[model samples]
Target chain A: MIKARVTVTLKNGVLDPQGKAIENSLGSLGFKGVGSVRQGKVFDVSLDVKDEATAKHDIESMCEKLLANTVIEDYQVEIV
Target chain B: MIKARVTVTLKNGVLDPQGKAIENSLGSLGFKGVGSVRQGKVFDVSLDVKDEATAKHDIESMCEKLLANTVIEDYQVEIV
Candidate 1:
């Protein structure tokens, strides 16, 4: 079995309201010197595949098909 | 300027409905050999603090206070 981690993040130019909310909340809670709180998603998947190459390929395909919204979010797949 | 990444994941044995939904969706989408689709949150934060120790400390505090639910989720903080 192979393990892979997929991280999906918003595009640089996209506005992240959730992140903005967190930043404001942090400030209200007295955490200073903090800025640019961008939120993203992580997926830890266990694969029954054999090789690293196949695992990466399948995971990338999964991101493209279902895991990530390619229009505004970018995804990175790493085999661990 | 310092940069940090905080990853929050459900603790073992915690119920993760969103993850289960994704797992089932993956199977429905024709991705085979996939199991244990655990989902999580990632926060990319930029800090105006100096030094790694202070940054790490502050980030950890953020996790404890806001980013994670201490009862059910575990968070990892890294200065990157």
Candidate 2:
């Protein structure tokens, strides 16, 4: 068994409302030093593949197909 | 300047619909080895501060105040 981890985040040019909301919430809670917040997603996946090559191939397809929205988000994958 | 990174994830009990959808998408893409996906969040924050102690304190405050929902998500912070 292998572990495939993927992280997805909004592209640099995209607006992140969820992150902004969190930033606003922080100010109200008295954390005055915060300037901004950017939110991203992480996925820890378990795979039952036999070798590294197959694992990489499958994971890449997974990321491209479902783990990220190519239009607005970017993704990175790590195998362990 | 110091860098603070925070990772937030749903507690073990919460349902992760985004992850589930990704898993299904992977299966349809012909990557049958995938079993489960647990989704999490990551935040990279930059702060102008001195000393590890103060940075830790402020980062903790940020996590508790805005980075995590507390009710459904847990968080961890790294200072660099």
* Chain A accuracy as TM-score for every candidate: 0.98, 0.91
| Per-residue C-alpha lDDT of model 1 across residues A11-64, encoded as one tens digit per residue | 999999999999999999999999779999999999998899999999999999
Instruction: List the candidate 1 regions with Cα displacement exceeding 4 Å.
Output: none
TM-score of predicted structure 1: 0.98
Error of 1 at B70 (Å): 1.3
| Candidate No. with top DockQ | 1
Best by TM-score: 1
Point out where model 2 deviates above 4 Å: B70-72
Looking at model 1 chain B, which ten-residue stretch has the lowest summed lDDT? B27-36
lDDT over C-alpha atoms for residue A77 of model 1: 95
Per-residue C-alpha lDDT of model 2 across residues A6-50, encoded as one tens digit per residue: 878899979998878877777788765666677888888988989
